[model samples]
Every structure is written in structure tokens, then in C-alpha cells.
Target chain A: MSEARLNTPISPFPSREQKQEERAARRAAVLRAAVRMFNARGFHATSLEDVATSLGISKPTIYHYLGNKDQVLLECVTIGLQQLLEAGAAARAGPGTGADRLQSFLRRYAEINMDDFGRCVIRTGEEALTPESVRRFRDLKREIDTAMRELIEEGVADGSIAPVDPRLLAFALAGALNWPARWHDPAGPQSPGELADLLVATLATGFLPR
Target chain B: MSEARLNTPISPFPSREQKQEERAARRAAVLRAAVRMFNARGFHATSLEDVATSLGISKPTIYHYLGNKDQVLLECVTIGLQQLLEAGAAARAGPGTGADRLQSFLRRYAEINMDDFGRCVIRTGEEALTPESVRRFRDLKREIDTAMRELIEEGVADGSIAPVDPRLLAFALAGALNWPARWHDPAGPQSPGELADLLVATLATGFLPR
Candidate 1:
């Protein structure tokens, strides 16, 4: 929740120094390929060989960097969640009425087009992981959910948001944020920002709010 | 959406007598196994052999009954969707107003706690289907969406619901309906009818339309 802690580095923040940047890019490329195949074909359906082939890299390199296929997946999901949480935390920390903070955070998330819509490892799907891995992802997921819920509750208390069940509101907001992975098209009529705005307005203003 | 049209046997629904009833039971058993597997392990992660093994049948028997893996999946999804749509339709036919119909339909879906929790094939990790499968599913998907949206639109027009973009309302209603797949638990605090009522009330009342 603290500003400095919120912006703290997530696995070194995918560097900008040339050598490090190239390495980060390759790592990202691997993660990207993994997500496409994992999401489209499924994580179990995909193999280390498949990921290596897609990346034009040796399978050994992947093992060296991320340990195994599961680790690679965990990293990808964690990275994505960390990004959202960071944005959400920063937004909440901003100087504004609760609505402004909530909107600011959600808009950034909405702009995340559907192409990268991997299921968050912290959500229930992490049951796909090994027992040890499950503990970690579950902890992270609950933390994120709790933090996000607190932010919304704050907005409600400040009178920016109308009275709504915080829990249901969480689900609704999470549902909208999570839906893009299921339906977003890069070539679609509305851009991510436009879609996010529409969602924000709809949730904030009840369709038939008295 | 004619009753006769839906009643037409689609392979699994072979006969009208006890023979057909037997077939339907067999089909439901197979679908139950498939759902359990798909939920525990994702679709691409699951193998036909695994499902066959779970059913205590040989691979050949599964193939004989359902043709191939894709067809089995198609049937499983069809079964789940048909059950959901039929429940919605029945509510529509028995309701007081369009809003009432929508609320009843929503409540019916909330019955995830009764026993059908996470059994809805349309929600949760469905992206891995082959393109051909996606097409067939989309057709059915469209009909359900249109039917639900029409109900919402009617509610708005009748002053029973607030006037909002029917399209967005459709999406939000969808978000609400599909949410149970993620969180509903029969062993949890809420009953199926209670959860459904809460959801319908939340959605119907808007922020405060109640």
C-alpha cells in the first residue's frame, strides 16, 4: 500500500540497458509464446519443446532461466498480476476522491487488450500448479483481491461510488476486467481504452440507478 | 427456439422410449466425467483416454458412443448449455414481467450451489476448442445471448428496468450469470436459490432502482 513499496521492482522490471534489455526481450518472447500456446492449446497440451521451438531457442535455455514449464507459467501470471496490482495500488494512493482513484486504476487495466489475457495464477486456476506452487499463488491472489476490495470499499465510504455490495461489486469489476481475455480482438471497432471507459461507466453508474 | 426443434434427437437423444432414456443417462454420465476432468484439468490438458478411463470404459467404447474427442466435447457443452438455456426459457414463460423474467432467469442460474456449480460449460477456460468447435458453439451462444438481451431490453422498455445500452446490459448480465462457475460452492454459505435471488436482486435493482 505504501507508494515506494507499490512501485518496487518486479523481477528487475525487464531492463532497458541494451544487453539486459535483449535478454529481457527474449525472456518476454518466451513468455509470450508460452501464453499463446498455453491459452490456445492449454498449458498441459504445450511442452517445453513447443515453447523452445516457438522461441527459436534451445530448451536448455528455458530450464536455465525459469526452471521448468510450470515456473515459466507462474512467472508470466505473476508478472501480469504484479503489473495490475502496482497500477491499482498507485491509483488508490493518488490524491483524488475515491471514484477518481478507482477509475484511474480500472482504466489502465481496461486498456490491457485481450491478446495478453492469461488467467491470473492467483485466481482459482492455480490449482493447476504443484502443491507448493499452489500455496504461493493462492497467497498472492488473496492478497491482491483483498487489497483491491479495500480500495473499492474506500471509494464507497467516500460517497463517490453508490451503495453496492462490495463483494458483488468486486466480482462485477473483476468480471469486466477478466472478460477481455475471452472476447477482445485487436482489430475490433473499439480500442482497449474505449472499452474500459464503457465498462467503468456501466459499473459506476447502475444501468437503472434510482 | 421452438420446442419441437430442441426436442429433435441429436445423436445422444436417440430414442423416445426407455431405450432413449437409457441413452440420455449414458450421455449424462459421460458428460459428468468430462466436466469433472475439464474442470480439474483443462480441456487441452485432458485426454480422451483419461475420460474413457474415468468412465470405466475402453477408448473404443467412448469413440463408438461419441465419435471423437471433439464430438464428445461438443456434446458435453451442448448438454450444459441446453440445461441452462431451458431453465432460462422456462422462467421467461412463467414470469410476471420482463424484469421478473430476467430476475427469475438469473436466479435459476444462481443454482450453482444446488449441485451444478462449475458445471456450466460456457464459462471457465473454454478457449482451447478447435476452430470448427468454436463456430458451432458460437451459433448456440448467439441464440442464448439474444434471448437474454431481449428480455433485458423488454424490461427497460416497460419501465421495470432502467434504460441502458441493451448491448452492455447483455454483457453485464452475462458477467453476472457466468460468475457462479468461478465461485459457487454447494457446501458454502448460500443455497442455490438464495444466491440466485441475491444476484438477480443486485442486477435488477441496479445501484438503487429497488
Candidate 2:
């Protein structure tokens, strides 16, 4: 009404950037809640309603943010796989011999498997996802496997690693690290970092004497 | 009333031992069918009807033989664990150093994991079972873990295996071997024995150069 009020230029609505940020935050929160429940309970046992109830939101709100339970699980596992892929890439780009880079990637891989999204990736089976999601999940997992094999091949070429079958060696190392997802107790004495180091060390030297 | 009839040895009905044997055979067949389905489709997604239909029987027949789905799963995993336990005992009793015994046990362990009931054990999550079933499952699994730890301890004491934490080492080895249940294909190029050998060889020496 007044010239001063018109010149103030303050709006009651949130700006576009603020609205986008809020939406992203809400989506992440819903995903976090869903993944934790899925991890604690089996995927079939956990309901989207339970996730929504934990977050003080409605079931429709979850659907709006994440589409459905299957989509939520797919997203969680994808994020975990992406983190592993990024870690492999980073390790490849970074340091010493092939052995050193492989170890670095392995340590990060183990640590990620112990976290929320990472645990979901390990705990989830192919039968839990839809056909399309399972295909995507397998594709992403294969890429990670290929990256590990490449690292091992490089190490072998440089004589930093032993002349072993890279494929089998990768499976052994990944299995040793991934098992922590099933057995590692977050409340136990060893932290994720500590457990990862011990596992990687065991895989490096093995049971046989040097 | 005839003398020949009175002296006849043949009977129309089966003997008690024969009946018992038949019953046992039928029960085993049902269990095999159920475990295969559970492993392929997952515990939650698999139905008793599907298992029965595959075997050309009805659902009640499955219930009659295995009690319920939970009981069937528990039986499957329990059989797998018992096989592992028996292998451990056999290895302990066999001739050789602790390391030799441990390797013998580990090979059998990997082979059993690729079998029907053993694959079921690896695929079924604790959450898939009822509370009581889960408790029993955990107890059986704990016994296996103890057996593995004892093998590692004996090997360490005899200087056959390197000095490492028996608990962590056992976890690493068991994890590496147990993973074949998820990835090993029965129709693949390698036989279970060949694959087991490869996996154990990888673990015995590890990735690092000797």
C-alpha cells in the first residue's frame, strides 16, 4: 500500500533454490529411514508404513519422495555401489604401486560395506529387487568387480602382487570384506576402520607363513 | 486253512523297517525340493505349494513332512551346519598337522556350500526364520565358528599357520569359502571340487607375493 513497503522487496514464499534444497533434504531423510529399517529387518519384513512412521510422515509422502519401497531399496544399493566405484577410481588415480592402490580401495570398500547404504547393498539379494532393478544392480556390481580385477592385474604386472588369478582373488578379497556387513557389530569394541584394517591384513598375508 | 497257505512266508504289507525307510526317503525328497526352491527364489518369496507342485504333490504333503515353512528352512540350514560340523570332526581326526586338517575341512566346507541344503543355509537370512528358529540357527552357527577358531588356534600353536588372531582369521576364511554359495553355478565349467580348490588356494597364499 505504501511506497516504503513496496520498496522493501521481501517475499513470504521460499526462493526457488531454497525449495529445491528442501526437497532434496526431505528425499534423503526418507531414504535414510527406509534403508535403516531394511537393514535391521529383512527387506520383506520392513514396510514403507513403518519407515514413514519412524520419520513422522505419511505413507504417501514416502511414495511422493521415493516412488515405492522397491525404488527406495534400488536407490540405496545404487548409492552404495557408486561410492565403491568412486573409491576405486580415486585409489587408481592416487598413489604408490598397484598393491598400495588396491589396498586403499579395499579399505574404503570394507568401510562402506559397514555403513547404512553399503550394508543394504551387501544384505540385499537379487531376488529382493524387480527384474529391471536386479539387472541394473548386477551391472553396477560387475563394473566394480572389473575395476578390482584391473587393479590386481596391474599389481601382478608390476610384481607388487603375486601371480594369482585376478578374478578368484577379487572374489576372495571382496567376500572377506563383505562378510563384515553381516557380522560386524557397530556397538562392538572394534570400529569399522579397525575391523577393515584387520580383514585386509589377513587377506594380504593369508594364513600360510611367509 | 490249506497247508501251503499256512506255511507261506510272503506278506501283503511292508515290514516296519521298509515302511520307515520309505518314510525317510520321502521326507528327504521333500526337503531337497523345498531347499532348492528356497535357494532359487529366496525364503520369503518361495511357497510350500510351489515346492509341492514341483514334486507332483500337494501343499499338505509338504506340511506333513516338514511341519511348516519355518521348520523346513530351519531343517535345511541345520542339515547344512551339521555337514560342516561333521567335516570339521573328520578333519580333526585325520592324520597330519593342524594346517593340513584345517585345509581339509575348508575344502569340504566350500564344497558343501555349493550343494542344495548348504546353498539354502547361505541364502536364508536370520530374519527369514521365526524367533525360536533364529535362536537355534545362531547356536548352530556359533558351534561352527568355534570349530573354525579351534582349528586356527591349533595351527598357530603348531607353527603351521602364521600368528594371527584366530577369531579374525576364522572370519576371513569362512567368509571367503561361504561366498561360493552365492556365486558358484553348478552348470559352470568348473566342478565344485575344482572351484573349492581354487578358492582355498587363493586363501592359503593370499594376494601378496611370497
Off by over 4 Å in 1: A1-18, A45-56, A113-124, A159-164, B1-20, B44-69, B91-97, B112-120, B123-130, B206-210
lDDT of 1 by residue, A46-68 (tens): 79898898878899998876779
Query: How much native contact recovery, as a fraction, does model 1 achieve?
Result: 0.21
Q: Which ten residues in a row have the lowest lDDT in candidate 1 chain A?
A: A115-124
For every model in order, the fraction of real contacts preserved is: 0.21, 0.73
Q: Which TM-score value belongs to model 1?
A: 0.78
**Pairs clashing in candidate 2?**
none
Which number leads on lDDT?
2
Cα error, candidate 1, residue A126 (Å): 3.1
Against the true two-chain complex, what DockQ does each candidate achieve? 0.24, 0.80
Best-fitting candidate, measured by TM-score? 2
Model 1's chain B TM-score? 0.80
Error of 1 at B155 (Å): 3.0
| Model 2 lDDT per residue over A102-171, tens place | 9999999999999998999999999999999999999999999999999999999999999988988998
- CAPRI tier for the interface of model 1: acceptable
